[model samples]
Target: MNQQPLSIPADTQASLLDVLREQLHLTGTKKGCDHEQCGACTVHIDGQTALSSLTIAHMVTDKKITTIEGLAMGEQIHPMQEGFIA
Candidate 1:
């Protein structure tokens, strides 16, 4: 895993969804309802579920953000994800 920490502004007003998609180029997190009505933009913030559409980019600077790309370890899928697949 080549996980590297991203340094972003602590006062950025951009949404987490935009940061993930446009900045980081992580397109796995889709943009559904920007109002958080749909769950398409769900992500894990410090191991907790969060709606990326509504999350502020600055608010997550001090926290770990896990997207769908981070869900697996090489060829080994996470057990929770395996369960869902089953």
Candidate 2:
């Protein structure tokens, strides 16, 4: 599926976690260990599992950065969240 590109400010740091939390205000992508030791900052970049903490924001500027917030279709819950509850 084709996704829209999310532009990141040039001044922003390379860390995807920081961009999402600070710039985009997507707090669902938690930051456990900024050193990329923990998997808490896991997110999907273009439908693939990505460690936002490790990835640079600028590198993925043209890519789709899917966080926990983007999972839901409006009020509906995403499949991942639903599966976890079951």
Candidate 3:
């Protein structure tokens, strides 16, 4: 479920959450508290949970970003998303 990498222009100044949602159209991550106080927009950056709202797009230019959409392996759904099925 790895998604295609985004090409971040050097002049771009949006947060990782913005790029993930607006640019790539990934809506799994939510913006609960724009101040990074809440864990709503949590995602994996290089395999570790991170607050995407706090990270800038240019800072993660070549990093591997995995959202809820990428948690699954092949046809298997990740357990984190199973709750939505029921």
Comparing 1 with 2 on lDDT, the higher-scoring candidate is 1
Ranking by TM-score: 3, 1, 2
RMSD to true structure for each model, in Å: 3.2, 3.2, 2.2
Taking all chains together, each candidate's TM-score versus the true structure is 0.79, 0.76, 0.82
lDDT tens digits by residue: candidate 1, 1-86? 11667885434788888888887888878899787688889899988999988998888766888888788888998785575468
The clash tally of candidate 1 reads: 0
lDDT scores for all predictions? 0.80, 0.75, 0.80
Better of 1 and 2 by TM-score: 1
Predicted candidate 3 versus true structure: per-residue lDDT over 1-86, tens digit per residue: 15776665543678888887877788988888888688889999888888988888788877889998888888999888796465
Off by over 4 Å in 2: 1-5, 82-86
Clashes of 2: 2
Give one digit per residue, the lDDT tens place, for model 2 in 4-85: 4555575556588887888778787888987768778989887899898888777775677678777877789989768645
Instruction: Give the TM-score (vs. native) of candidate 2.
Output: 0.76
Q: Which ten residues in a row have the lowest lDDT in candidate 1?
A: 1-10
Candidate 2: worst-modelled 10 consecutive residues by lDDT:
1-10
lDDT of 3 at 61: 70
Displacement of the residue 15 alpha carbon in candidate 2, Å: 0.3
